[model samples]
Target: MLRFILNNDDIGTALPPGMLLLDFIRYHQHLPGTKIGCNEGDCGACTVLIGELQNWAMHYRSFTSCLTPLGNVRGKHVVTIEGINLPGSLTAVQYAMQECAATQCGFCTPGFVMSLTGFCLSHQAPTLTNAIAAIDGNICRCTGYKSIERAAARVAEILQPRNGTTPAQYAAGAQILPDYFVQIPARLRTLHSTLESADDVKAQPIGGGTDLYVQQHDALGKKALRFLYDQPALKGIRQEGNKCILGGATTVSDLLASPLLQAYFPYLNNYLKKVSSTQIRNMATIAGNFINASPIGDFSIFFLALDATLVLSDGRKERELPLRHLFKGYKQLNKSGDEYITRIWFNLPSQHTLFNFEKVSKRTHLDIASVNTAISITMQYDIINDIRISAGGVGPVPQLLKETARFMTGKLLTESLIREASFLLQTEVTPISDARGTEDYKRLLLAQLFKAHFITLFPQLETAILIR
Candidate 1:
């Protein structure tokens, strides 16, 4: 039996496969604040706020209903726009949206409201940057983004401090699980063995359905979803030893709210803000971005530049390895079929380390990268001491520019040096043609982004690492 509190009500039961979230909420649960949109997961019309216990307490994030599966909701609590209404009147967020005239046609209103609710809780007030980052994934063909930003900020003024705080960290493996992904030719069993095979078949784990939902167009049917929806560790954002460990299910929105990340990786945050729109970031996980294995994953480039490591486990043996080593040539990971990534740890660099990120896309926001670059350089007495540079979207898997790193060793960054070094990169790397950019276009972008990073990292070493 899967025991969960739905909108302050309790339910414990079993369900079938391919049960879209929008339907489950409206039909089975009889809760209808969640609206159905383009069932294909593109339109953000079916968005809702989902809450689950992590570290023995509650944490909430917004997600799209069209792509979400009912089985994924086991043991979790869901709150739609309807539940968000206060006891006597409209919630402060709704009032703000009304005051700012944030809606048009009102079809996308529920999704927009839930998304803003999550955003306002995490960020006291929305800045232009925050506004852009939050709603970038949502579409309002009727009204532009300007009005939404105004509403979000207006809501912030009403509730400066969030009503509650998130609980302590919980590792995914150790948390209290209401159910596991047991293949159901048979139904759910006891409290502890929801995943036990009734037909003795193993389950396929699903996290942050952000990408899996997008895979509906594929010919092959999606594997039965084993919900990792409430895995505490997969939702965590905190420090562990010398590295900052982020869970695979941790949303990009949570990444921006992280004080640790903000203090240590300003450039990384800046680029992630531009990686996708506010709507997508609200649900997409850092690891999912890699799991999707898009050639141009924004976080992939940043992770490589940060010397990040991926931690993989399967309720048994656990292994940790550098992320760059995961690429098995193309669209493939070096997993033994059952092994899935549980968390990612980014090792912290020395305090004085200088790093910069540059993303080249056709548009400023909500677009895939043509060429995304991340550069990390540490200077010792004004000479290059250590360096790591990475490029994404150019190769089958995102990787560090080893040859480019080699060119910068022991050189002083200067205009002439940056220009020459960039040229060396141009000669060493080759990019394939794609819709975002052609082979020659990518080559030029790679060289120029390197130069831009060098210039951006100025004053620390005005000479520029690319020049060196």
Candidate 2:
């Protein structure tokens, strides 16, 4: 049985764990405020705030209920639009939308409100950029976004006085969120203590369910799944000696929030912003992205450039494999079904090392890459001491560009060297024509992205001559 707090009510259901949260919210709980759109996680029309107790406080993040599984919400507070309403008036977020005239068709309004409410209940600064980013996953076709921008600005303005108070405290005090949020932590502690453990050996392991539900939604309902999203054993980011270790279930949003990653890669946010929307990042796990084996998976390519290692486990034993060797073919992995990734670790980039990730997609954000690449290089004065390059969407699996990296190593940093390396990169990839782009287009795009990595990292180098 899955036990959780849905809105203001407690829920304990025997429904299949893989059942869509959106379906449960609409059909089972009869909450029509969370509308369904795109079914996939693209449209944020089904967005809701998932508040989980962490470090003695409630940390709320917006999640697309359409891609979220019921098992993922166990022992958590699932807040819908209705949960934020006051007795006889709208919450501050709703009032902002109303005051700014942000609503038109009203279909996407709930999602916008939920996302904005999440921002108000978050630790992020009350800035227009952060406010707009909180609703990046939401799509509004009617207002052309100007009014929505105004509404988001208004919401941020309302939160300007939110000083150092906890999200729940500030939100409840300002009437941005209900006072019930203040009592959720204590309620969750009790709920978590009485929660039953699922120990079915025959169950399939699922992390996040952001991608799995989209590809195998119907089939998942029939299979027993072991939810790993909330498992205590597989959830943390810590530095051990020279390596930075990450729990396999760590979400993309976790990476964005990680101080360890930010310390090493100063521009980490700039690179991750292009990975996906705020909602998808909140639920898409690092291991899930690797195991999905999409050619253009953002994290897979990003980690590959770092030469990361994966620790695979089967309950009885553990084994380590280089991430580059994990993928054998298209949608194929080297490990067995029983073997699951439990931990991922990589070397921390030193001051001597420079890293950059580049991607070209049909859309700048919230879209899969047409061609993506990442490069990590250690420079000794003007000479390259060591280098690793990885690219995706130009091969059957995410390619480490071993041959290209080998050619670039020990070479001087110059436009001519980058031009030669670009040629080598093209030879290493076997791009195919697909919906994203043609084979020729992908090859050329990969070459440009390869040059982009050099240009971005080494701004002083006149590498513009290598673009062609």
Candidate 3:
């Protein structure tokens, strides 16, 4: 049985664990505020707030309901637009949208409203940048983004003093949501006690469902599913000695929120911004990205540059493999179906090490990369002591350029070296002409990206570079 609080009601059912939250809400629960557009996690029409207790406080984050499985929300509070709507008055988000005339056709309005409301309910500071980022997942054909931006700013003003107060408390007092939200934390605690775990045979493990649902939503119902997004054993980011350890089910959002990772890699947040939108990142797990084995997976390429390693397990036995070696070929991995990644860890960059990630796609944000690359280097007195470079979209799999890396090691930082390395990388990649770009284009792009790594880190070398 699956159990969770739907808005103000406690509900338990024996529905298939693989059933999507979007289907259950619209068809079974008759909640229509969450529109279905781009059934994949894109477009954000099905965005909704998922409230779960953390550290004895209710924390809220917006999720794309279309890709979220029911089992993933077990013993949690699921809030839709209807859940936040006041009986006789508009919530702060709704009021701001209306005041700014942010809606035209209104198809994407509910999602925008819920995302912004979640922003108000979040523990993040109420800065204008954070406020605008709240709706980065949504797409409106009306091109009324200016008005929507204004609405977001107004909502941030309303939430200026949101600190020292739980989002539920502030929302309840301000009538942004019904007072019942204040009691949800206790209710969830009670619900967690009554929940019983069920065992199912022939279950296909689904984490986040961001990618699985996009690829196989229609065929998932008949397949018994085990949702791993909330598994405690496979959640969290920690540091053991000099290595950063990430659990298999840890989402990109989890990495972004991790203090350990932030302290180790101060530019992590900026690097991840090129990966995906907030709605997708909130659901896409690190292990899933690596296991997906896509040549263009941003995280796969990112971690490969750091020389990350994965701990593989089948519940009883475990083994470690270098992340770069996990992929056997295009869309193929070295592990079997039953074997899953338990954790991923990499050494923290030393004081002499410099790391950078570069990505280019049709769209700069929230789109698949045409070409992406990352570099980690250690230098001593402007001489490269060691270097590793990884790239995607130019090979059969996310590849670590061992040849190029070896050539650059113990080499001086000069324009000639960078140009020679660029040419060296040309032979390492095997890009094909496709929708992203031609093979020749990708070849050129990788060269430019390689040069970018040096120019970005050492602008003084820009004048000396003649790679182009």
- The parts of candidate 3 lying over 4 Å away from their true place are 199-202, 466-468
Per-residue lDDT for 301-357 in model 1, tens only? 888888888988876888997888887777888776667788899877777588888
lDDT of each: 0.68, 0.91, 0.89
Per-prediction TM-score, please?
0.80, 0.98, 0.98
Cα-based lDDT at residue 278, candidate 3: 88
Task: Between candidates 2 and 3, name the one with more favorable lDDT.
Answer: 2
Off by over 4 Å in 1: 27-33, 38-42, 54-57, 86-92, 120-123, 126-133, 160-201, 217-222, 233-241, 459-468
Alpha-carbon runs more than 4 Å astray in model 2: 463-468
Candidate 2, poorest ten consecutive residues by summed lDDT? 459-468
TM-score of 1: 0.80
Question: Between 1 and 3, whose lDDT is larger?
Answer: 3
| C-alpha positional error of residue 302 in candidate 3 after TM-score superposition, expressed in Å | 0.6
User: Would you give me the overall lDDT of model 1?
Assistant: 0.68
